[model samples]
Target: MVGRKILDDKHGGKKHLYALNVQYARSEFLKRDDQVLAIRLQQEERLNARKKAAVDIDRARAQAGQDGEPYAEPDPDLDEDVPMDDIAGDNFGSKTIVIHVGSQNLRLGLATDALPKTVPMVIAKKAQRSEADDSEPRPKRIKLDDHAPSEEWFGDEFAKEYIAMAQDFKVSRRANKRRVLPNSRELVTKWNSTTPPETIPEHSDPLRIDWTELPANEKAAPDYIVGAAALRIPERSRPRYHLYWPVRHGWLNEKDYAGRNMLERDFFLILEDSIKHELGLTHRREWSQYSCVFVIPDLYEKVMVGMVLQEFLRDFGFQRVCFIQESLAATFGAGFGIACIVDIGAQKTSISCVEDGMIMEESRINMKYGGYDVTETFVKMMLFDRFHYADFNLMRRHDFLLAEELKGGFTTMSDENISVQMYDFHLRAHGQNTRKYTFKIYDEGVLAPMGYFRPAIFDHSDKLSGRHHLIPRSTDLYNGHPNDPLSKAQMAVISYVNQAIPSAVTAPSAQPVRPLATPVAPTPTKNRPLGIPSHLNGDNDPTPRSSPAASPPPDDGGTPHPTGDDLNGDEIGELKGAQPDTEIIDRTVPVMPLEQAILTSIHHASGMDERKRRDLLGSIMLIGGASKTPYLGQYLEMKLRAALPQYPKEILVAPPPRELDPAVLVWKGGSVFGKLRMTNDSWISPLEYDRLGSRILHYKCIWHW
Candidate 1:
């Protein structure tokens, strides 16, 4: 069931919410032996669970001294806060805060609740950037006020006329040398207090917002007339700008207001002002505000990481911001038993081992190997294989089209569809062949990382083709450590198997095979096939039962299959004592069994070994992006089972949480650990580390969550 939901999400978006109580669902079936027995067991288990639950409810009611009542307390705190469920039951106190951050596509969600959830929000509704066209016709000149001319100012006319057109419109300028207008009373105070009476020309280069003096109009002009009046305004020595505030939602019925729009407007203005005042460098000068939220201003070509964070925090009004590795979040989210988070992202694959939900330093492992490498490999394969078949006539065309197509699809660079030209050089050069040749993105074979795994497909890009003049070290096949066994395994077997057979891998050998040493004759034992004596016929001659009808064994041929008598089949049943039938493993027991086995080994070992376990006494957690591999739990389960063969096999892996990023589980667990209402306890902080060094951070096992 865990694998099912994960696999579904990997393929499509619709299956994400399908929840299966894996442990409960799994217990009903017989342990991979008989379906009928499993069905009976399943029914019995369900009935038992229902009976237990009913008993538990009855016991709870009796213990509470209210045998029939569902609940006893009538206090407000006892009631579940329906409205505030998303943010710790929404008493809406002044202390309630939320923080969020996002990229161009996803707007992260944050609140005063447990942890934050990242929600996707497009920055603009159906808006996109295009290359500026220089050949377009120039607009006719217009003027704003009689003193200001239109030719000097170029922007939306609505921006200039909004104040005059609507009585509700309010215009605010940067109060001090700060280039941003105030959003709240506190910011306004900061602005007024920080302003210098005299303009400091040298310090205000990026912060300056020079405005052209506007003269009073002789007569009242129509709203459209302001468009023409702008023609006379002279361009200021520095870029001219305005902060326009337009309140739309809050102005309507107070009961109908969502409050989100106002919050965004208020926070955007505050952030914009801070950035402008501190960073400076202004070119595109106009910004619009709807209530309190500020919209991203025009002309900032690339999105900055800090700005993204700022926007999210403003939108959500969260106080604190914490950064957790994405892979860790995903790994934990996927229900990988180990706390380690393994993330194979678009650019790289990172691994960090966590213990007790905290990432451990020593166990962290990462590699540059990721989706990009796969794509490059795909490109090389295509050029060598595809172009060779075509005989190189369409070589140049193939290269261009492949690069453009791939870039467009993955990088979101171009919106237009790509077409490639291919020539059948094999056919046209000497008329040796007659078939035409063509190349397409969909047909170019490649592999890319999907979630924690990789799926092979076409590279779909022409840009990566063609030989580079400066050939670096990548030609050796392996990126680094050419002789590395793991590298070989990844390329030849693991990657191959993953692409060919997804979800699970079956072991190859059909026989119950172990590492066989040099051939040895079997010793005669008392346990014999049908209990027949070896020397039954007499003289003890080695050769006995050769059939006359059987064909003679061929010389220089492969090994022959053993007969039922030779295999000792008479002593074994059909369903048991054979390779495939010898073991039908419970998959979940293999991966995570090692953790408990290791822990149990430490617990039960002799004095020296027990002392060794003491070194890891404080805060053991699983970390690493790859720890979320679906089969990891099963793998560990087997190892643990083997390690602690004599102990009860009840060790369980951490279950994934219902909401928030899974990677944050360890961190959240750590947070929960630190924040417990204790009588007197020492909580470690970064400052304490600075003061007392690493010695302060160390603690005993009791400190662990």
Candidate 2:
């Protein structure tokens, strides 16, 4: 955006003046000037002399073989056998692959397949051991709460211990401060939690491996354990590897050890392995036969999308690629014209308003906490009562997995609460003895899930010490503050400017300096296009200083006469100028309450017509893993009805049509979208990507993203 503005100020105020685009403007003005059109038409005369003289000899006949025209030399410029006019690019619908990349899972299969295979979006890399046996710095590791015994207890301390169960992700939920009925909000008044989840439980031999039973051959761990297999690895073997969750909590998971650059590498590795082993596309050549439809989040980074496109079409050998937003695809899957989609993934939750087939950009949000939080809360609640399996440590893979299984099997949100019940389970480890144990759970099963409605129970940050510094908030291309590191584009500009900093520091040179090679701000004029300071742009209008005479547009060979204000001029210098920042759009900046989020999304229906707001409000669909929780939709409906009292008699929470599973609804929508005839024009082949760059998404993606 910054570079485009800089070029516009240097040229005529319009992008229509660019050498590549000027011809279209020229053609439009052709009719206005009949003389020019006539001259242009006349100039299109035959290049070769009309009808060669007889003296030329039988040159044409001599060149031609016995076969007329010598077989036309096979027409070297002919296109590939693939149909260029068809929108699906080089592949057909049956060969098309639909990949739904979720925070916790990766789903991929052919569009024609009945179901997509779900793989965990996690990997465990072999760790390099050191001589000293220093502990690997897991900034995510849990530590005892800092609150002293004499000091008054804090809910954040309880929340801290609760979140420590799934230490990989940091939960920062923003509860709505919206006005509610008297005493409606759930609050922890007296630190009623009998046991604060502060200190890590005393581990049974640090990990409870029972290593005596393992054989020698099984001791050697592989280089990597990926997907579901990674989580199910021997509990004792986990400490030897460093876990990496690529797309954690719906954003690229940034790790201090791998650094930011390796994010794409990890992402590519996860997908690459999943495709290689899970789909049985072992050879890269096989990928060429399939086209891919990639599902991206409603709120996504442009760079992330670019990375995915590059991986699929450029690196992975896919013939073509297309991106569809999760919310938009959900509607397609459900056959809904307009609805609010709340996707509650494992570690992240997103809500968006989709109308027809497009997701409204302003109405989309991605929150950090999700169904996984409920799992953690459930574990914390269980620990409060005197219970067995007290050695539970989430840092261990077995314990973490058990917690997830517990959440899925027991946690519920129904109003009819069941009394404490007895339960039994067998804990099995690879090459180890299986142990059976029995435990009784009280209302914790139901109360823990209710934590989603009560943020005070487990969504605290201020008192949860080391959360920010330990597990720092993940950064991407956005979050444009100086504290955040510069991206490749920003770093390139700085490096270019640094080259001339030495010259500027020395005496004024007799030699002229070029643009970024010399650090200098060419004083901008208010009247110049794009020259007004951002702060003053609203008050001050930009007017081009001069309009030069129009020149001939670029020819088919792409040659053009430079405009007067082009960089070819004698004076052209620039220091690091202000880059355009998309700070105004608050994307998951706060983890808004579910009801408030729904209300806000309904109110901010800029994409849909005003008349459709009512239908959009009533026909809300809650999908994703968390949405499957019993009574969640009911509770959400209750909250929404309270907030939107004026809406119809009830706030309808529609389930997927024909009993379709809510969790897989988005993937099914993508499959349906893949089968559409109109979607043919939306796939981007690698050739188009090379020519148009990441900007191709603007033309190809169905949604505004």
Candidate 3:
């Protein structure tokens, strides 16, 4: 007896043979015929349809004067047998979930309909125009996966491609369109007989398929679920919980402090306080365990993320949380793509490059330098140079705290000129003579280092050549004349040029000159001897024109001017003769020379070698609250040009908060990374996680490349 096996004809009809068990059938059926029954059945209904299609094809071919070949019948053995159990179960229409996790934040979205809403689709990723254009001052770099697509995987197109690939493999789906079936089941059977059977065919009705064990490519659709475990839990199992609070610095929380402004205190302290407060105020005796995954796939970003989140969570009611770095999460997020995440924050800087988002520990680069450094340098320069009128001593006295105030107030030239009023006064200190000092009483651009990172008064001026007086005098006196602009700008340009040059020679120490007898100078007019100019001039003077008579300085350093007779040659002494050459070279004028050592430092600091350049490029990220300093980007651009002379690609900087607060970029980056949807389909489950635990935790880092 044939088991529950199915058969079909190429014409379209299908038949399922359900034979009784031999033992059971013996008692039920009296007549037993051991034979292949040739029961006459109607030709497939699809034959009519096929005939119509054939007729149409013939008419078209005849109209085009082209003959058509006869169709061949398909082999019956090609019909595949599917286990009955494999062909049954489940509904297609269901709610879909969209989840996003980043290093800094986590967001979940749901879509009942086929399309996801705007909120779920928008992921936070920012790239700066300046970095792309190669306009940044310091062009640092990071190495990225060579095979990673240059274009990002974003938007509907990215999802569409995945869907198309899924469809090609014939996993049942109604992608962007609905799938239709004919009224007759015979047509389907006939079609199934001819078409190759898929383990899971595209046309299998939802009622006949299991949702679990779907291919990832097909499962990636919006309608598919993640872990489906989330769906099993009752909606009332957990209540909606929201805890929103400002985060503080981790350092502050670690070292407790008593201050009037609690918000300004350590972040950890705030989190701690919040948790304590929650315990005191809330009715619940316990809460869910707070297991945090620190996505520090990059050392710097990890440290930063750890610090910030630790502080932020301290205030929460939840305790006993686990922390996993975001870098690892990113690995799970991207599936197979390698990536580099350069996290630039207000106080910290981190660069993590991963072969697959999970950074290999050996490859991370975390540096102390960040946006704050850039701001500090610019703020000091502003207070000391332009605003202070080159009085660096006074500027030096201004502390970082005070300088921040000035920077916040006086950012632009107009702001400095209009708002800042410096008063010059003499003050006595410690019974010493009173000293004169200038104080900036008011200014707006005087902000902390955070403010100068992006846009600022002075963009990228390599310490205006020290040769130029710290500040141009005319800078303080801007006349309405058009020449004033030209003159002042010219002075600034010259100052820059002179400052850049190195001073090779120093002036000789002052020395007393010996007195000599009053000497007569040779006269010019072709009468003086060729060597007369050298003979007549004093040793100290570079220019010694031959004329009539001029006397060397007396013992008291007194000298006399020369006349025409002194410039004349010896023939002139005879009363009349041709003048000898009396040309004098001016040695008093001096040009500054280049400082090789400092220039070398600048070049070296810039990405010089290809490996180092690539390394630097890989790590280059805009950071710090102060990165907004005007033209800071240009300064970095100039430096990169000097540093990485070989690489043609421009260094890219992450865009800051001009559109939004750039300071939050790292945070946003982390938040987005943390929220990545990593299900059992893409990542190892807790059980398998244990299997790979040793390999991951004790993962050996390859240092060589």
Candidate 4:
């Protein structure tokens, strides 16, 4: 009664696995109008299938017999090597290009290259005259220009009182009270003192364009500036320019809020411009010579992928294109056959378990929180202890860079009882003269990164008073177009209802077990395959059909369809047609800790046996910039082991092999993957894409996506 039909994975499920016959699962008591026609069709399909199988067998036998054995006789030198010049399953080709575009950066290079060129994933475009007029650079905001003039804090009256009390209250360190404050040690970071402007020296300036303030002599700025330079464009110059981060929280940012046309343009332009500028492949002719290996996130929208590929093959003039999941690529890059890969990027954290290069669907968890969140946590924690620059805001470009620098330099995961001390870093803000600011932070440096395990810290960071939404879904065209499938009437299902019914059958009875081999007499339509529709039975049936959905049959139980006798004023309604489903999107804000997320993802992997699960537990691999916090891998391993005591294998969390930065591991894997011989047949060329459209992905992808 129980059976499973697993799709063959070798061919990426190109071989269709027909669904089980619904008639076999239906009750024999009820009857429908078209049962006879459906039964005949089903039988015809079965017979045709058998004939095809027999013919295939015969052809295989004839071919095998003609070919015979490779050697005429057994030889003692069987172990000797047979030299070959060219292997078919070698590198995809020398012209292969690997591109990995993340929210924060883009890695691109030829497969043969040793290291991929990294570029910041940001773009700045000059604003039109209507939008750019009357712009000015940001005024100095390091600290109070005149010392000891205004109140020391930047919040409300109650907040000021609480902070003043906490600073002098001498709260015990051991208590670790909720009101965490820094001690009144000698201030390394100056308060109430403003930064003195410093002049830029010649020969040291790389761009030599004076990024702090736009060219004093030039009439206008360039049309576009991307990568690190984009961030260097100061606030005063922003009215003349705008910056867009095309990707956020692991997807196209604000598809619903931002028009589809805008998203499409932003994504295409950013990638093309970045590639051209970084790789020095500026012309369409240059692009056409190379095939592209695009590394996509493990959990991604199919529509997004299709849109990206459509641009690459149809517009970008690439010779060929293929996509690989980030998790699988990371595995290849790390030389791991089975492991759980955790990626924490600037704005998203994704976890997936890859076993033998196949990413398990159940273990794919993409949460909307990552390194940026930690930066935000740092700002909030600093402001609590009377931060010198209390008017800080991330929306301001310079402020964000300052906070990011702090998070990168000071934030850590180690618990070695660091002594409380004052530290300072020079703030080289965009368009602003180099300035130095000082401040003292005790537990904040460590506790800020700890927010990864305790997301509650973020609950109060944003003053929206609640969680803010990142991206929205207005359109999803994963299957070519959004047009509805063939109407149910045209796609009527093969009827399964029995025409005959026993009128006086008892309410219920134990059913007898039927024999397996119940033979039936030969039918007249032997040549015509079972399940072939009359319209499609001709020798030259050229008419094409669209994808189908079956029409639901009228109720067959509760009250049989054929015996539609009016009940004696007792029955009024029946369950028949089901309501159609509503549109759904895959997105969730981060609330769970890294440890819980990894463990839950591994445990939820569908179809994974116990042995594989154990192997995954033991080989959990941590990647992403946030995961690089010192000693974070060991911390995660300890937490996972504590949760699963019965597990025999020692749970280990390994960073990228050879101590490579987790940030570039996935891109490295893509470079490695593009060179593999097995991927030769996987490349989807422009011709194939044009012929099949997005549907070609289902047939060519290495795994059953």
Candidate 5:
């Protein structure tokens, strides 16, 4: 029964999927007076019955003089292995791998696995020593060829080395301080005995050392560090090491080649390591057998970037590769076909509408409001309110981490004034002192995440101008005053049409208007269609014909015969007359608020008629780590409902499942999809790609078009 309930909730219930007679009902049972009263009486009677039954059971037990064994209720919460019949059949023999590379994380695992192994998508360069340190003896290099290659560290191992180096520096500094004190005292005594006390040299304060700059190695060598290790570097040492993020705002950073290369190298290493770890394979040849699927943001489909990524993967020895949109993957993972996905990622938020496995690209909106933006807002608010004395540059990382913790804690609270204690050593007055400072966050904690839904509160003053291009202006022909010239012209045209209708029906017979003596035929131009002169072929026709042709006589109206040339000319005139003269708006508009952004995207999706729009408005799904902000789904639902109040009450706001991490849903969905035999057609084999080129992706990936 428990398994059935879980399956029903996830798969939308068998009835919901197959019911043929589903009806829309909006009756309010609670509003009926008799029904309400009956419900109250029924609740009271049930409570009394439960109490009476408990009393009778106690009396019976007492009469029995002690039961052989106390009846124990079944443990509903106890773990139970789901029967094979209830679980999806496993096809582990298939050689497929799924990888989801997000702005914040990289997830990879086999299709048979329920989840993917995730790592941070960041790379840090190890700090390099100053040129002065070159004179020092260097560690012996391991020669692999004519010259030994420089050693490099990545992932967790790189972080461990940096941390250990920091620890050693701290311990050595403390020992140096202890030795300096006694030596200074001895020097003072000697000066007092040998020379006058007043002549003794004043003891210089211990020199302030920059621990972050201390060389970790004899030679000034820098290596790249990646994943969680990059984030573990000490705050002070961060400036010395260059941090590189390969992907930002759901796309590869094209401007920085070095950083981009480091990111690529890290990805390669991570992929190779993941395959070895998950599949338990050691040889490189074993990797060639598996196919790979990557889930990327929808924006990548706009350009040649997706093809570039495919080529990159091909270089990595994957036999086959497939691409899936992040939003579509999340919708599929959640077991839904039609949904408006709002993916709040680390650096950006993406809102897209998907229906029947097809993404509405026109309705997709990507904005620069996301989890990091919230953190930045929190930091700014704290600095403005309490930490005015501290340097923002030095305290940024420390406060960012603190703000993250505060956001998580405050999200669970209901109070308006929430105080959080944050400690930072950077707040110390002097290098010698180790003092901690506490920062108290108030309303800003809640206000920061709320910006996602009500962005007007957080938006810049310049951006708050509600100038929409679609809103019709008074200057528009339809909206103009009756006396305005444009309106008067339209009125004149309408009056002419009305008069022409009656005149044509009641007027006496009129003489036929003669066509102008065919203008002196211009000299024929070579290469013109049908040997017609360019001047007479509509390109440079001097005389403009404005009047409509006379209506045919009533007897001839049904069988009016016109020349092909006359028909062509009349059709051209009608086509030109049908077009409107509205000016096109410029594309350089400022960013919009989150609410307007979502609505604007929905408005532009192709084939979205009234019913489809209403259906999309009814199903909005919020996913990603940033979307986990408390009450976000409810807030979005309220705003969306208000935006389209005419929609049915069935509209729902699907928040990420509490039992699973929202950030990894794309990966999970990719895993599920990758395991299916139908997905085989989606995979672009290396040979196929080589033969057809990148155009094949347009057909294989549903979101590409």
Candidate 6:
């Protein structure tokens, strides 16, 4: 019975399948479906719409052109009125020229604009034609005085050209060697060392000339290549060319005359280019209409300031020139009054404490630990530890640049292992191979910046003991003899007090019960005249009592007595005698760790005022390029909070506004300051500078004053 049931089920399934197949075949043969035709029609309509839209756009554009109102595309990056546009108008009164001169970059802009223009703080010499090219007529040069004007290149234009030429040289070698070349444009070599050499023909080709056989006269003048171009020249040729860095560690490089000359030349060109080309002010007469504000480092010497002022006044002939401290300007730019500003620059990190819009001079610390040091440390670690590359001489400027890029890239990632392909690096072990080397950079790459926070990571022979002293050596406490007259005075007071104390306890008082006689007639002193009746003396009398002096107030071990000038001569003498003759034990240590440096600065600035210290610590402003490092602000805040555990845990580390840049915070602040009408007093006119000399800056500059 089971077998018979199974056979019957199988037969029913086969019959059902046959019925479904027959039905599907019947449906396919029924008709052409409307759904398929509808889809096809929709696609056709979409194509026609697109074509019509294109035609309509072209027609509209043509019509707009015919009407003499051609369509102008709106730039998303620019505001309603750019700097150039604003300069064209007659409303130059509200505008100001703001310049922030940094060690690495230059930031310049009009106060009315939203952001400043940034350019490399570098100047390169324009390529000079060789003696062989003397036959060619020279182009007319722009003259500033009786002397012929020297050719120069400023900022990004020279940088771009240099980098392009360098890369072209690199590619040219590979192409000449029959190696795989990078996809670059056709090489065009310009004469007099200004451009890259043309692509070398095959050895068999007649056009191919062996560069090694070239005569000394035919060779490019190494001195002609300046700025970034200097990096591309062969090592042997670099000596002839002078690569001048006008500013180092945020001040004029006073070590040599060349640095000073380069600084002046670059500054002059920058002003000329901005006025003549950028703002379309060709005539020299138009320069007087504009006021300039220059942002300088906080720790600049007075002589440097004077030099800069002199240059601007004598050379550029600006109507007015103002100087602002970088830290103070950054504080204002960040929109904060009291803050601990940590500016990590390319070559140095300057920590300063600002309170109520004024810089606390005593609490400033400048150190040579910053982004450049971090890159150098990373490069060293990579060379010695990771790759073990023996040939350090082979490492070019581009290698360090690539290392910097790698360091920046490492900051943005959380991965422990960062794989970098250094195409330019030539590993001696992998001799003559064109293959790129891949390095797995781990802890060294990620923790290179740690040295900035931890000074011990770097080798320093002189161990710093206490808080670093930023004050000049001449005015320092330990500068003179330890047993100076001040110390002697303190000792004399102590000896006098010791001798008088025992006698005062043992000696009997002369005229003991004479209180009634004193009440009868009290002598009046100059501070309190006898003309005023006792009844006239109200509840509040600022003046001291004229009657015979009462016994000294008993010590309550609370607050110290007010040390004001109102104290009588006798009282002042007694107070001076009471002071101990203890030496000031110069406990200040030098070259402190970054964290301690910050805390010590605040401690010194605040002194015994706990409230002031707390206020400063509450608002820590971290600015500069180094501050852009990942987790730097957070790490600093963590360490700061840990060091100052007594303060509230939630200390606010205020960063610059999201729209602003930390590296250019000072520039932005300068721009803001220049725009405001209230800051007009800060501007120092050329006439005032000329009349009073550079000393006028000391008075006009609020921070300096």
lDDT of 6 by residue, 70-171 (tens): 685422221122223321133443456788776666677777667766655544343343211222111111222324212221123322433443354345
lDDT of 6: 0.48
Question: Mind giving the per-residue lDDT tens digits that candidate 2 earns over 1-705?
Answer: 111222455556745332344445456553543344223322232111112212222454565754467533222211222222232133355777788987778888777667788998878766653211233221121442434321112234554543453221111111333222222111221222232232223353245444322235545656777787767655445345566777756666652234555667777888888888877888888889888888887766555676688778888888878888888889888888888888888777777887766766556666556887677667656544433444555556666777777888887765354444567665645554455556666456766766555443554231122112212322322222212212221221112222322211122224332221222333443442222112111111111111112111222122111111121112221122332121211111234456655655554453234456667767888898778887888878877777666664646876787888887888988887776532255777777678766656655666543
Q: lDDT tens string, model 1, 452-552?
A: 22222212122111111111111111111111011111111222222332322333335433321221222443433211222111111121111112121
Give lDDT tens digits, candidate 5, residues 117-228. 7777766565453211222111111122323221221123322433343244334436545222224223322332233111112223232222333346634534555566
lDDT value for model 3: 0.28
lDDT values for all models: 0.27, 0.54, 0.28, 0.57, 0.47, 0.48
Q: Candidate 3, residues 160-188: lDDT per residue as tens digits?
A: 43234323312222332434233222332
Q: Output the better candidate (2/3) by TM-score.
A: 2
Best-matching candidate per TM-score: 4
Q: List the residue pairs that clash in candidate 2.
A: 87-680
Give lDDT: candidate 3, residue 189: 26
Clashes of 3: 128
Most lDDT-accurate candidate: 4
- Which ranges in model 5 have alpha carbons more than 4 Å from their true place? 1-94, 127-222, 235-240, 255-283, 301-313, 392-400, 411-435, 454-590, 606-608
Q: Which segments of candidate 6 are over 4 A away from where they belong?
A: 1-95, 126-240, 254-285, 386-396, 411-435, 459-591
Model 4's alpha-carbon lDDT is 0.57
Winner on lDDT (2 vs 4): 4
Error at 364, model 3, angstroms: 2.6
- Candidate 2 lowest-lDDT run of ten: 537-546
What's the TM-score of each model vs. the native? Answer: 0.25, 0.62, 0.29, 0.63, 0.53, 0.53
Candidate 6: give the clashing pairs. Answer: 466-589, 467-589
What's the distance in Å from true for residue 552, model 2?
A: 31
